[model samples]
Target: MTNTETQVPLARFGISAVEIARVVAVFYARVRSHEVLGPVFAAHVADWPEHEDKIARFWRNAILREKSYSGNPMREHVSRPDVKAEHFPLWLGLFHDVLRTELPERTALQWGALADRIGEGFRTGIVAMRQPKDQPPKLF
Candidate 1:
């Protein structure tokens, strides 16, 4: 066989669409109730159900390869002035808790790792977006 491969799809993690729905639902429920994140999200999201559905679509595309998601997540997050870098850790902690509660141990662990990476990306991107272009980027 050529050096080609097929390891990119997250579907190999055995995540189901139903689980994705449940996790997104639970995680956002917590987010809305969170003291630090609730107000930030409430400022922009008028329709909770619609926002949850769209997020579910994103996870479905990421985990199930449905390719149904079409939104720019980084743009969405970075454009919001209230979405501070401090919120990502809280968001991810809630997410990991939901994952651990909703999925099997190994699956939750793998999904948590993926979420960690995604959260880091969001945090760094938001930080850079807020940084001045003329000044040197903060090393930390």
Candidate 2:
């Protein structure tokens, strides 16, 4: 990549709400088509349209500080039995891929780090939930 592409300014560009919505929509579309994760996601998201809206709001809040999302992500994931430790890495990989493909280099890197942190947090949380209550917490 050229220096210009690699060194894009860090200013948020004030990415609009509509643009953020588009990003979430496109990302989820890609996720739904993924071979390794599609079935797991589909099985868990019975009302995918609603789930999509919730996810869009979450991303908007995360990236734009919009306070648009109020749902508990941990609660949602923990409630689903199919989401396991291994699934997190797969999900992060896919998310990183999508960001890289759809966004500028700087933006991709920014989002990639965020994705990694969130994935690690979720993985650790999920493992903790799976453990016996009497056992000490397992650090990730």
Candidate 3:
């Protein structure tokens, strides 16, 4: 079977809270230093520790389904005028890189898939938000 035909079992390779914290820490460190994404993130996130913790909560909720993430991520991303659809790919690419470097293959793939979906959703939301006021709203 082709690689695409193989299904990754959802519950088999779960990430621990410590792993999540590690990923978040390393990932943001890279992001903070990146040429393309760094300035954009720095402009909005004045407090790194608070922002990192919030992001960890987001990933914890996403990967472990812990229900700890309460913020409206799409709304938050949309509010950042410097954030464009073009940046989402950069962000996701960085995320994928960190996951591959820090995690086992199956674990990285699982988290990467979830990150991709979230990135796509954020991209779509940002694009829809950019549409002219007269245009009909895109389905959420």
Candidate 4:
């Protein structure tokens, strides 16, 4: 586990709650209008504003260690049959576009790197979920 004291704060990279909120708001707006992502999110999210607020909180918790957000992101995504593993790339592409446009180059690069790492985690979890229960972990 990473010690909070040792971990570098995202704010050092110019990632504040304000920046998190902006990214969530703008990225989701594009997602809602996107040809591929729109339908997937629309089916689950009833209130756009409320969903955005929750997502912003999630980003704050993740990036800022606010400890104010709730819900299991991996469980949420894995539960959705429509959220295929391939969708991670699509999601990251749009998120990267939003991050680059909303933040300065250095900040965007840092934040995008973090997002890439997290997206890989989610994709790995989803892949594990699809594995056969009777199958044992491979021995190297």
Candidate 5:
């Protein structure tokens, strides 16, 4: 079978809390070592312990559909003037890598698509907030 044909289906595997934890742990490990994004993330997330828990919970809600993680991710980053539109793609790539490492291929793509949509939405919203009301929304 071709590689694509052998890929697992999203419905075949259920998302669990353990999977969420694994994704968070692996993703942060990469983030901490990432050349382009490490300093940016470190400068913003001063309290690693608290940040880790919040990230875990956010992934849990996103993957498992448990309690809604209603935190405004855009608001969290709005104050960080260094964060720009280019950063979103790097973040999405890292997130996709984490999902692929922790989940099946199909599941990874599914999660990646969701992350892309969310990241685009958040990025657009953040840029919009930065713009004057008279200006049109910036396209990502």
Candidate 6:
């Protein structure tokens, strides 16, 4: 519960390209219509189709470690000042919801765990990236 630590959730394991694509597609559809997260995405992403493809590719690479994606996701999110740590749960929830319905129970649980870990990492990075200007720096 320290200031430097965050709530880390457990995750599971990978998947196929088509399944990954479906997960991304369903998840983004919910995100686009989400009241809280919709605006955040819309503000940063102008092209939904392109963004969706990149995201699908990113997930595919992350899950399979296929080395297909090249984008630095941490840097991308950290650069967005409007993105807060609180938003991770909302995004993760939507992702899990879509996975459960579109995928098998085991598949959903595995990806749910993976998504949780990813969200935690992203949140931690975002918080660290947003440290106050006057805060003392620490090497950890």
Highest lDDT against the true fold, candidate? 3
Runs off by more than 4 Å, candidate 3: 1-12, 135-140
Better of 1 and 3 by TM-score: 1
Q: Which stretch of 10 consecutive residues in model 2 shows the poorest summed lDDT?
A: 7-16
Estimate the lDDT of model 6: 0.82
Q: Give lDDT tens digits, candidate 5, residues 1-140.
A: 76459763333236777777778878888998999889889888888777888988886776665564779788887777888767888989999988987899987888788789988877787787788889877665
lDDT of 1 by residue, 26-102 (tens): 98889989999999999999999999999999878876777899989999999998898988999998999999999
lDDT of 2 by residue, 18-40 (tens): 76666677777888998878888
Per-residue lDDT for 96-119 in model 4, tens only?
999989999998898899899999
Q: Which regions of candidate 4 are displaced past 4 Å?
A: 1-12, 134-140
Which residue pairs collide, candidate 3?
Answer: none
Estimate candidate 2's RMSD in Å: 7.0
Q: On lDDT, who's better, 1 or 3?
A: 3
Q: Which stretches of candidate 6 lie over 4 Å from their true place?
A: 1-14, 133-140
Check candidate 1 and list the clashing pairs: none
| Ten-residue region with minimum lDDT total, candidate 3 | 3-12
Clash count list over all predictions: 0, 0, 0, 0, 0, 1
Per-residue lDDT, model 1, residue 128, is 90
lDDT values for all models: 0.88, 0.78, 0.88, 0.87, 0.79, 0.82
Q: Per-residue alpha-carbon lDDT of model 6 for 40-136, expressed as tens digits? A: 9999999988888899888777787656788899999999888888899888888888998999999889888878988899988887778887887
Ranking according to lDDT, highest score first: 3, 1, 4, 6, 5, 2
Residue 128 miss distance in model 3 (angstroms): 0.8
